[model samples]
Target: MSIVAIIEFDEAGVATGSRLGDAATPVLRVDDLGPTRGDGVFETASLVHGNVQALEAHLARFVQSAAMLELPRPDVEIWRDAVRAVAASLTSQGVTSGSIKFVLTRGVEGSGVPTGWVLGTASPDFTRERTDGIRVVLLDRGYRHDVPQTAPWLLAGAKTLSYAVNRAAQREAARRGADDVLFVSSDGYLLEGPTSSLLLRLGSRLVTPRVDLGILAGTTQADLFTWAESAGYATGYELLTPDDLESADAAWLVSSVRHVAPVRSVDGRHRAVDGELTGRLNAALDARTS
Candidate 1:
């Protein structure tokens, strides 16, 4: 089952209200720019045991993406209400683990008003990937690590609706017989996965790639860093390389809905899985209240 909420925006493009609707029904027009030109921004947050995890961070990123696309600034309060309502509806139906994705789009062609909606649905089981782990391959992202600085027009850090390239990368990974991909900058610096962030455990320290490397800031990674600090692990952000990943005590592809999935292999070379620590990390993530 799924839930959808159509957000109503004012003349100034501020979200004023929302109404529950059928997910199977059409709410967008044929000429909406989001579908026509991929002119939009979106954020997906995980719902665990009825709790929406890292909502504020997701909302902040949503606004940043909108700004990057020059779209109307999203009204956080209204979007929050729609997200919560949809989440609550899913939880009421006994869906414990799910995802809520809210999107803002440049409205129909010639119409200045924006289109927005929030949708919620139960997530697929990720137990196997979270436990046994996945194999990944390194692929060139065709951009330098400094692309965000040199070319702001690329929208490299923004979570836009244009994901054909990312999907194509995943398909290539499949062709290579790998479960996923770890995108490396053309200059050979580690960036991030198509749908997740890379977290590496180096001894007692937890490190992720710097956010300025034209990658989305990982909300899940930030939360894990906070929890790791309390759990006696030092954390830092660095410009990492494939050597760093290969030398790490353990590595994971962390995301909103998937939580933490340890990387068990790279290019078919087996690596160690930190089952105990991975379990603890997922437990901490699943226990988040806000």
Candidate 2:
């Protein structure tokens, strides 16, 4: 029944489903502002069929992202179980699907290393983004998926918690009036969406940015590729430029909660949102868990 003053965690026991709240005692959050500067790292995964989907992959990425920020690793196993336990609790209440987000902070630590972490849950409300499809605009920005020097080595590819820059990029797109923003480096390579990975359809190939090039390898995107290959689609990855995206057969902003959704427009230029492969991709993904 007890919770921490800082809301350190919103998790409970997996077997018993009891929330272990943060301590009532207050803890000074000196580094809270750092995250505002895109100084932290994070990872997320979905809960499905009463379990944490891709638990190992999520936990591994969480720590990997932390490493990118030069932050100390938390007890990842403990953190992993907390995610599972919370998802199980939700399942007990008839919630079949939801998303789990785990954020690691360098709070109160003088040297900017991770001092603690937090995780949160949201119910299966992914339909809102998926059903309507997402509007998007193209940034002259670039995709650094191949060159590490293209982005901050410390924060690149780690999925760090600090996402103000990413959020700002999204807002810039929204300012032009869109639901989401696709950020490409100024050099014209497709990095990713503000908060999701980029998935584009080219012929029969399912292509995304390679993880080495500063792209956060998306768990859901990987799942889609796995499904794609099994369904006779050739899944592939390469360093794609904005030129390629603008002319691609179809484009998508891929993420955990939204699964795979089509991009209706890009760079104030209108494109068709309705993609013939949308239903097929969704069906392939569904078959994975079903």
Candidate 3:
């Protein structure tokens, strides 16, 4: 039984229609650019214990993504209300923890406006995966690290809804019996995971790929870096390679929802899982979210 609700918004960002239950579905025009041409942007957040984690950050990114796609900037206040409305409805239905997604599409072709919505549903259980860790395989993203800077039309840094390639990479990883995919640039720099940001521990230093290299900036990674730095851990961003992952004391796929998930293996090579460090990082993450 899934507890899911899709809340629709008008052109003005006002919540118009809300539906619950398995049979309820969203009605979209066949020509909607979000579906037809994948012209849209979205942000997903973890709603834990009735609070949406990093909501302001998510909203800021949401607006930035819309701007990157040349879509109209949505009203921030209205989006907040929409999120609250969805959270309230789900809470009334006994949902304490879940995922919340905010999406905005370019609307029907030539309409010149956008269609937005908020979806809240029960969060999937990843406790086992988080505890035991996950296996990942490196996949080439087919673009050089500097492509985003030189080719703006590719929408490289923006978290747009055009995720066909990302989804396909994950499917291929699954085909190879891996849990996820770590995307590498054509230039051989370790970029990010299909759904999460890649992080590694080099002694007391925390390292992640440079965001300027076309990977989506990870909210969870940013928060963790702040907290870790305050706790006396050094953090740096540079072009990393798979060899760095192999040499790290520990590596993790970090995200707002999954928190800090240890890497059990990458391309069949076992990476050390420092349980103590993972626990500390998880604590820091939980403290920030809480």
Tell me the lDDT of model 2 at 39: 61
Q: Which residue runs does candidate 3 get wrong by more than 4 Å? A: 1-23
Per-residue lDDT tens digits of candidate 1, residues 1-290?
A: 89999999877666789999999999899999999999999999999999999999999999999999999888899999999999999999999999999999999877789999999999999999999999999999998999999999999999999998999999999999999999999999999999999999999999999999999999999999999999999999999999999999999999999999999999999999999999999999999998
Q: Per-residue lDDT for 147-169 in model 3, tens only?
A: 87799888888989998988999
Arrange candidates by TM-score, highest first: which order? Answer: 1, 3, 2
Instruction: Write model 2 residue lDDT over 51-141, tens digit each, in one string.
Output: 5666677778877776666666656666765666556656666766666666556654354434343344555566656655778887654
Task: Work out the TM-score per prediction.
Answer: 0.99, 0.81, 0.91
lDDT of each: 0.96, 0.65, 0.82
Q: Please report, as a residue range, the 10-residue window in candidate 2 with the lowest summed lDDT.
A: 1-10
User: Could you tell which candidate, 2 or 3, scores higher by TM-score?
Assistant: 3
lDDT of 1 at 148: 90
Clashing pairs in 1: none
RMSD each, Å: 0.8, 5.1, 2.6
Question: Model 2, stretches more than 4 Å misplaced?
Answer: 1-19, 22-39, 111-114, 142-147, 150-154, 274-276, 286-290
Clashing pairs in 3: none
Model 2: how large is the Cα RMSD against the reference? 5.1
Q: Choose 1 or 3, whichever is better by TM-score.
A: 1
Which is superior by lDDT, 1 or 2?
Answer: 1
